[model samples]
Target: MRAVQVTEFGGPEVLTPVELPEPEPRDGQVLIAVDHIGVNYADTHQAENSYLAPSKLPLVPGGEVVGRTADGSRVVALLNGGGYAEKAVARQDWAFPVPDEVDDLTALSFIVQGSTAWLLLRRSAHLAEGESVVVHAAAGGVGSIAVQLAKAWGAGRVIATASSAAKRELALELGADVAVDSRAEDMTATLLEANGGKPVDIVLDMTGGSTTDGSIKALAPFGRLAFYGMASREQPKPVELRNLLGHSTTIAGMWLPHVFTLPGNVFGEAMADLFALATAGEIRAVAGGEYGLSEARAAHEALRARGTTGKLMLDPKR
Candidate 1:
């Protein structure tokens, strides 16, 4: 089996390709012949050893995969690591069947970005109908899906923030009411103006640090900000207690591993719902680029530079 492993964490260059023995599935696990792998910002973190989660050296850094079993069942999976390989084992519950209409790359997106968008909006934030929402990093993997899911979940107005013109356009094409530059000097101003000169009811924040501060400022009275990944990888800026207290604002943090580790099958249920949406043509995975296993470094660089408009993928067989 061929895999990309970071023997010593440093930079994207450390994601070197190597030959490795295929992993066997454990009692409650399934071994997948990976067809497509989703390249997430977390992969960049794992490559740099900056991710908050525990990790060890000689790590294969990938968390989402789309593949088929020996029985020919196409499934998407969420793994702790080792998804950069052609064959990887994952917990049985972590694997969800991919609909016939969904391709390998799209199925890969369903596990990570898709579930994140679905769970964060539908469950964590409890986004209600007719609520005005704002999505940070709105053209990236989770954010791109979120822009659509927010509207599908009944958000009346969805404003998107991105660093590039292409991403902003992609966000709007995905159904955002407005799109603005996240790198703008006055993010709150642009976001507010886009929202018809009003604060947003729900803010989906991906990059932490300064972006989080802007999210805090952009919330409406009694609004919620669902914080997920810190794509910026900067030390998080503390949210002033007064900020939340002033408008009855709430800052909610989410980590998918934590959700999957919870008592019941919250992860499984969410994927089911997301797939149903895909089947109904409500939500989808917008593919940005596809790379071979050896091109893992390029994928990470692209993700870090925030140049992609949708999900980036790694194909071990490529």
Candidate 2:
């Protein structure tokens, strides 16, 4: 098997393709012949050794994969690591059947980003119908899905924040009621103006640092801010306690692992629901780019440069 491995933590240059023995699935696990592997910001963090989770060196870096199980059933699987390989093992509990209508790349894109958006809206923020939501990085993988999910959930107004004009246009095409360029002026001001000077009820905050502060300011009284990722490249600023004092707003941190660990078949039900949405065309996977396994370094570079929008994939068959 060919896999991208990090012998040591560094940059995109540190990711190198190497041959490894094929892995066998243990009990209660499934062996997948990987077709498409989703590249996430988490992958970059792991490659740089800045990930919040502990990691071992000489690691194969990937979290989500869309492929086939031993019985040749198409499926999407989440892994702790080792997804960068041509073949990987995934716990059966962490795997979901891919609908016949969902192609490999598309299925792969939705499993991670779609699930994150779905969980954030339905669980973390407890988003209500007719409530307004502001999605940061609206052109990126998770942001695009978040925008669609917010619209599907009947948000009164979906305001998207993007860095470029192209990205803003893309967001508008994807059901965003309004789009703002977060790089210019103040994001909160733009969001308020777009919403007729009304604060948003929820904020899907993927960009941290100063943007987190602005997001907190843009919330309506009792609004929820679900912080998921840190794409701003700025260290997180200390949040003022008073920001939430009178408003009764809440700042909740969301990590998918927590949601997947919920008791009594919660994770299975959520995955099944997301798969149904994909089958119904209510939600989708936006695969922005696909690269061959050997081009792993280039994929990392593209993500690091922030030059790509939507989900990126590695095709082992390519």
Candidate 1 off by > 4 Å: none
Model 2 / residue 239 / CA error / Å: 2.0
Clashes of each: 0, 0
Query: lDDT value for candidate 1?
Result: 0.86
Error of 1 at 83 (Å): 0.7
lDDT of each: 0.86, 0.85
lDDT of 2 by residue, 1-318 (tens): 898889999889999989999988889989999988989988998998887897788899999898888788988999989999899999998888877877876677667777788888888899999999999988889899899888887999999988889989999998999998878567678778888999889999878887887778888998999999887667667767886788888988888888756778766776777777777888776667999988989998998887788999998876
Candidate 1 residues 193-237, lDDT tens each?
988989889888888777777777878898998988887776567
